[model samples]
Target: MTAAGLPMEIRSEGLPTRVRIHEVGARDGLQNERTVVPTEVKAEFIHRLAAAGLPTVEATSFVHPKWVPQLADAEQLFPLLGDLDPQRLPVLVPNERGLDRALALGARRIAVFGSATESFAKANLNRTVDEALAMFAPVITRAKDAGVEVRGYLSMCFGDPWEGPVPVAQTVRVCRALLDLGCDELSLGDTIGVATPGHVQTLLAALNEAGVPTSRIGVHFHDTYGQALANTFAALQHGITTIDASAGGLGGCPYAKSATGNLATEDLVWMLHGLGIETGVDLDRLTATSVWMAEALGRPSPSRTLRALSHKE
Candidate 1:
């Protein structure tokens, strides 16, 4: 570490020179909050993320308020973010109605959340795996017709609490389906965080063999078993560039009790910078933002790097 709390730059062999971090703090992070954050605070959090140079920050979800009350203020919150680039502020749209809500608000980019396992599909979406994919098909098609970019989030790509270890073939089939349905990118989510480095590489290779290119793939790993960073490095070695991370190590699958916080932005950035990878983010500013958010949430951040750097500050 340097005197300023930054990591020493040491370039890694054959890694992408730059990585696009799809910051999910405001949308994914706060959605799991026990209490509903004030709409203005959510707006401010997004502004801070953008100012910290996160290229794509998921702004909010247009899911029905009955489902996710934490983001019930999506309609009110999105307008406040008009000052930011709409393309960079992707929102989650669960169905056609959700897509209509997001489009009415002028969301230029949207994401559809799905599951790779039957249990998660039923528990999270109240449908079978195939049924959930069918539901997303029209939503994705409509988004594409409207010229809105769509990202597919496939949770439980590695293991499921109910189903145990998910098969690589099963994951690749669903990934290809989502891509076939017109999703511009797919974020492989180890929702219960049971993935190790080898499992990650295996899944990535399976997807590649199934004709899903690494350039169109991103990884979202949870740190439940303390393997998120290691799994991420495995993906990096396979040429997967986009990563989904939450600030302050916030967010877990509300439907999956065993799931924990996502791969923390602070932790990921520390590793990426140490490897001399470019993320275009201001580490100090991002850490400060997470610290501020931790205070607002009335808890200490779970991020090791955030805690360490903030202590020095």
Candidate 2:
């Protein structure tokens, strides 16, 4: 057994084998910022992330400009992306209208988000949990018909700013709804970063009991309470391999008060590497990218490991 008391036999072939790092800094990370990141800068950020060997990067969101003005340049930005390796770029779509916009731009991969918390759903999308699911059903069907791979997000899975502790059954219900709607993968988001290892264990166990396979689930965490990495380890213990992270520790829910950023790509990679989990990421290069982006954003990285490593230099 490993240090966490999980089976050692589940370890991958090589030490720290590659895991898919979903770069969400451009989309999830920047969306919450008060300042508008210039289109050119956003494009350059994506280029730099790709150069750092990140395979899948969420480039931008296609929400209504009134809702998220930061990504209002979605149309202009989409074309500017200019021949990105098609496999590397996935964009976020909020509803059928957003999906239509993405499909018109020839986007083959897309993501849709819903919330496990009723309050979060109403606050973020102005809809209830069931209403949000109903809204996305047609969008998911359209995307599948158009041959697009769809990823579903369950936000506020751990806790919500308004609702406090969220029940695991509610989260699983959302997950099953998305899966039924044909989402290729479902990412559980700890929107307020209130998740603990114990919570992660309970949720994953519940999902497993509900027959949701580990392969179809992904974990998206925030560092608001500094429990992201610990929670990540817990998810890994439950056989969850896919993880969502952002460069320079960028991103938090705009609807979540006093929320911090997503689990930093650098920190998550460091822990996964130490645990001999193959995330197929280059830690040194990832850190360099984080440093560059942090400089561009004019803020110090929130990644503990990145901050420490840079200090060592």
Candidate 3:
């Protein structure tokens, strides 16, 4: 049986033996950081992550400089990462303008972020849920026509800071919208880090009942309230194989003050490795990378695994 008391046959059936970790420390992790990390440093971070065996690394976002000044060097950053697989570096594109910038720079993969709750949509994107999806529709089509893959991110899928408990149907509707708009994948985000394992299973079950393939979905969990690992375990039991993580737990929602950083990559890796799951990431190297970044940030990583292993480092 799974840790949550889920029956082994039920939770383990069709379970994937390997999980894909989508590294977002370069983009999402650093975007909210107070200091504007040097462009060269950011490029090196990406390269180091690839060398450490991360298959997919979110390099940076193409949002306007004014919106996220930390990633203002997206143009310069893209060219520096030419040595890495273009498809592995997915840049966040806010709209056609952002997508245009990435396409001009020859980026092959892009991600568009949206919200499941109306309050967050208006606050984060200054648009209603439908309006945001409408804007992404054309962007998805243009990217697809250009042979680029688009990934959709829906935040506040579990609980919104302002809206309290978000109904599952609301999140499901947004999930279907993104998929219908030609997105190849949808990442459900617990933006405020309020999700429990039960909530995760229920939502995934709802999405499954709605005929959304688990293969097309990914989970993005925040570490606040100390529930990130528990939530991730629930996602795994449901056969979810694509997990989003930030090395050193290096990001926070700019709009959600109650939220903390993402589920730490080291913490997730510890759990997956113990479960005999293959992630192709060297634990020692990954922990050292987090430590190196912690020093750069002038603090320490929020990852418990990293902390527990720091003595050896």
Every model: Cα RMSD to truth: 0.7, 4.4, 4.2
Best by lDDT: 1
Model 3: CA > 4 A from native: 1-14
What would the per-residue lDDT of candidate 1 be over residues 10-96, giving only the tens digit for each residue?
998999999999999998898889888999999999999999999999999999898899999999999999999899999999999
Cα shift from native, residue 296, model 1 (Å): 0.6
Better of 2 and 3 by TM-score: 3
TM-score-best of 1 and 3: 1
Q: What TM-score, computed on C-alpha atoms, does each candidate reach? A: 0.99, 0.93, 0.95
Candidate 2's residue-wise lDDT over 43-75, tens digit each? 988887887778888999999999988999999
lDDT tens string, model 3, 200-279? 99999999999899999999999888999999999998999999999999998888888799999988887887676778
The TM-score obtained by model 3 is 0.95
What TM-score does candidate 1 reach?
A: 0.99
What would the C-alpha RMSD of candidate 3 be, to one decimal place?
Answer: 4.2
